[model samples]
Target chain A: MRKWILLLAVFLAACTTKPSFTSENVYVGTDGVSLAFTKNSPPAEVFENSIFPVGIEIWNKGAYNVEEGYALVNLDQDYMEPGEFTGSTSIFPSDASKLDFQLMGKSEISQQGDRDTIGLTVLTKPIDILSEKHTSTVSVMACYRYQTFASPNVCIDTDPFGIRENKKSCTVSDIPLTGGQGAPVAVTKVEVKMLPSKSQDKVVSQFRIYVKNMGNGQVVDASKVADACSSEGLTKSDINSVSVSAQLSNGIVLDCIPKREGNGGLEGYLRLKGEDYVLCNYEEGVPMELGTFKTTLNIALDYGYMHSISKDVTIRKSAVI
Target chain B: MEQKRVFLGVLVIVSLLIIGCSGSKGNQPTAVEFRTGSSGLDVTFPSGTPQQIFENDIDVRIPIQVENKGAFPQFDELSEFTGFLWVGGYDPNILQASFEQGDIRKQLDPEELEGRSSFNQQGGVVLESLILSVGDLPLGTAVYEPTLIFYLTYLYKSIASVPVCIDPEPRSINVKDKVCSLTDFRKIYSVAPQGGPVGITNVEEIITSNQIIFKFDLQNFGTGQVIARDLVSSNPNEGFDWRDLNRVQIEDVRLGDRSVDKCKPDLGEEVELFQGIGHFQCTLSVASIASAQAYTTPLTVTLTYGYAQSQFRNIKILEAIEI
Candidate 1:
């Protein structure tokens, strides 16, 4: 009976413990995808006029499901040709047309973290007897849609109302902040200041948001891709075009758009400079009743990312009897 | 049996004869031809040349050629000529030799040479006539050969220049292309400039009213000695003495501004890089400039001295007596 009672108490104590949260918003989807050649079977050598297998491993480490993912192979047509795989097609060196997609998986959801492997078969072209050995480089690329996030908490209070200390009913002190997260773009810093308006019923606040390009991808307009990222026909935009929105705890929404300065358009461009700090202005129509509130700010960033990894293979022309 | 014995005895005699010839050849001495040293100077009397003279030959002139086969050029005049050639030997006992007072210091033109003297090309040569004064020996003195050695001394000067970057302020704008600036002249000029026979090892700068003074130390980078100019000619009273020799002139002080006028070598017009190393100080007035921005300028120094180079020729001295 005592052992049973002790077990019940331990279970209750365990249920009462709160789960810890990440200090920053995590875009688990984008940061989790990793694609590479498997260690057991890498692209090293292939005999001329013969077929060989190349293996690739793709890992999905995000919280959400990958709707579509694929790998494309680029090779020199004069020296080699892709075998009759479903996605493999003949491409010239100068052919800039996007590679035809091979579906790696459909609705592949990674709960904790899961890795998938695929095999690609390739054949080398015939060579002359005088040419004993020839080297060719094959490039492999992975393309997919991903998401990331950044969250920063700021203080919003109306403290100078001359309320008696003895009758103090509200106070806002040091609250732990959630830092910045995501790929390609990250909110490096955020500062907020509230100033009293001359009118008796309103107040104005200024928000300075710092954004940085953390990856090699080109940031572009999200609307053009229809909420999904595409590697084709990628045109870049400036910082002024970045979309930002904020909301108070009382369900009041505020939009902060950047004004054009110099060569930077309405959304200042980073190609001209390297990074940017955007100033956002927000005005409250009604004065707060001497209290503290929690607010949320949303930052939307869109970009086109491309990664090219290559390997060298030698094709030998066997000696004829 | 007797015929075999005879054949064996003949074979033994032939073998002994062959061994005797081989032993004699092995004992013979090998003739080795020595490399006549310029070992400082390679001067020697030509083989088969007559050394003994008759009483009638009072001041007979001998031809001595000095081919500058060394790495450095011998000059006659630093301002105009390259080096001087003086031919005299060690022993003064048996013979007294004299050259023409004015002709004693002769100039060898290095300009006429086909190629300039560098690490690759051999230096030029100059041939001059040497007069030998033979004294009266007792009637039966032993006839022997006395070496006619020659000594050539001249002042050798080496010049080098370093680009000193000077700005009004004390900081280097480009860390990669370090220059001498006002902030730290010692740090930049702590080492010497390359591609010259001489190096300006150390330099110091002092800025005064309308004038900046640069103090420097010069070092010889060659294996040879640097001759002091003042010691070259014995008689300073004579007009041709090398009193003003070994003069180092700083020429073409450029400060980017074409309007920079009166940039003078304030210490003096000419200073000597004495004993391979010399201390030099000069000043330039920067007060006239309208702007005090930092800039780079070149400093060029030219050294002039009567350089000396030497070579040795082997000759055989023969005895010639008149009855």
Candidate 2:
């Protein structure tokens, strides 16, 4: 009896699938490159006329490598100065307090993301004669270009008049998705509809893809990311825009309409203000005899994300002064 | 020993008495199984609505209590909602309602609000605040009394499943022990009304050589009036008018899977209920190729109509400080 029990256990174990991490699974997470102030980077209190260090850590928690990224620190210039970290001799983020590049995202070999740090020594300028203490908010910005890859199963029904319901593998319905799909932006839902063709040939598939910025960052237009960090200042339109394009598994790209031109043909990308969706139609109506089938809808969202974190530092007057 | 035996006999008698008493009166008081009722919804304006309000009183609230008092319940999956309610009959400028023109058309219950039954005797009561502070009442020279009419409109369905005998040849005298006689079909079959305010009360059958004719009598068991589908205004701006009452739409009359297409209402498809009853007749064509064997099919009569009930209130807006 004991031997039979052992054999039964072995058979059950063999039937169960051993869980393993695939290359696709490594890229799935809700995190993106984030900026954090190290513990006491700007000490709780700093004496007047004394020099202190402000530090920021840039962590790439996403799967995609950031080709062009930068971290800019903002401070009240009246009460502080870069001191020796400025002028022609300055090496800190090229004297402008902007740290660029040198960060790699998550990979198959290293499941965890790579991280880098930046520290800058600065002087606290003298305060007014009467004020005993002064406090200022120190903020840092991390901006990077990222991409989201989503492959959700889609239903395609070619036959119109034929009753293919009982035998069909897939039904046309909205597919709701949760959790992030390998990037800062996530495809939340895909509404599937098999509409009758206008030419009276057969039924065509139309999908509405809804995307949201899951990461705590303001989305930017992919084409304008380089310009945003460059000499040209970032405009209002440059923010809250995501470039989106989608295709089917059969290599037939979907034609998404209601496009707003300009921005590297991200296929008339949607302007993201919290959440948005795009409508794509399979224009070449499938031949009537194909019946009902299931295929994957591959969607790619290419955009720039910018996140910010702020800290407080109290400036106390020196005893002798 | 004799006294102990007497005591045992008394105990047995007492046990028998208790069992007999409980068994005889156990089912006397139970929740009433309400199959027939006169009203689907018992609507009444509760207290707090002022019959007279001064011009200074900016807020005048009127509350209307809507109770599902019939056997047909309002379910989310079966029907979108019980019906819509609107209050009109007063000048919009003088007495302005807090609700918008679109907001006036309100659904009775979005979720499941069951009607009268043995399980839920009182049914579901939805308190709808009708006039939430009728404001901007002009200070007239004399006492101004405006009659405000509050109308409730909702689509309701009434179904009747009647067991009917299909006779291939009713004139065949040689047939012995026939399944059901054409003259005695009324006594053989019964009409079961499937719980709606409007129901089929009686049915009379007529047999011909090639057709079976059925005459049905439909009545409004509800206290409220039935309205024509076309007469009710769907436009939010138009609201409810007085001309939209007393007509019921004959949706379908079917026997098993096949629809009896020859069914016709006495007046028309949308016929007005005289007093509270209406008549509908349909001719079911019997195929000449049917077998001599007699079979029975449940003839179903479905009616879709808008039920409406109204309550009017006369209010006088007096001057803030009497002259």
Model 2, position B193: C-alpha lDDT score: 55
Best by TM-score: 2
lDDT of 2 by residue, A141-244 (tens): 77788888776655665643444211233356788878777678988999988888877657778889998988877888887765665557688878888777
Cα distance off (Å), candidate 1, residue A261: 12
Backbone Cα, N, C clashes tallied per candidate: 23, 3
DockQ, model 2, C-alpha based: 0.00
User: Second chain only: TM-score per model?
Assistant: 0.49, 0.71
Q: What would the TM-score be for candidate 1 when compared with the true structure?
A: 0.36
Residue A206, candidate 1: C-alpha displacement in angstroms: 2.8
Give per-residue lDDT, candidate 1, residue A131: 88
Residue-level error in angstroms, candidate 1, position A41: 4.8
Instruction: At residue A33, give the lDDT of candidate 2.
Output: 87
* B1-323 per-residue lDDT for model 1 (tens digits): 99999999999999999999999999986653221112121233444344545432466766665554332332432243344455432123334555656344544445532122332244444445666654543221212133333444444333344556555434335444334345533324554433233445666666544555666676655433333454344211111223443454443333443322433343225556566566666566665555456555655544433332333332222223432
Candidate 1 recovers a fraction of native contacts equal to 0.00
Which lDDT value does model 2 have at A198? 79
Shift of residue B166 alpha carbon in model 2, Å? 34
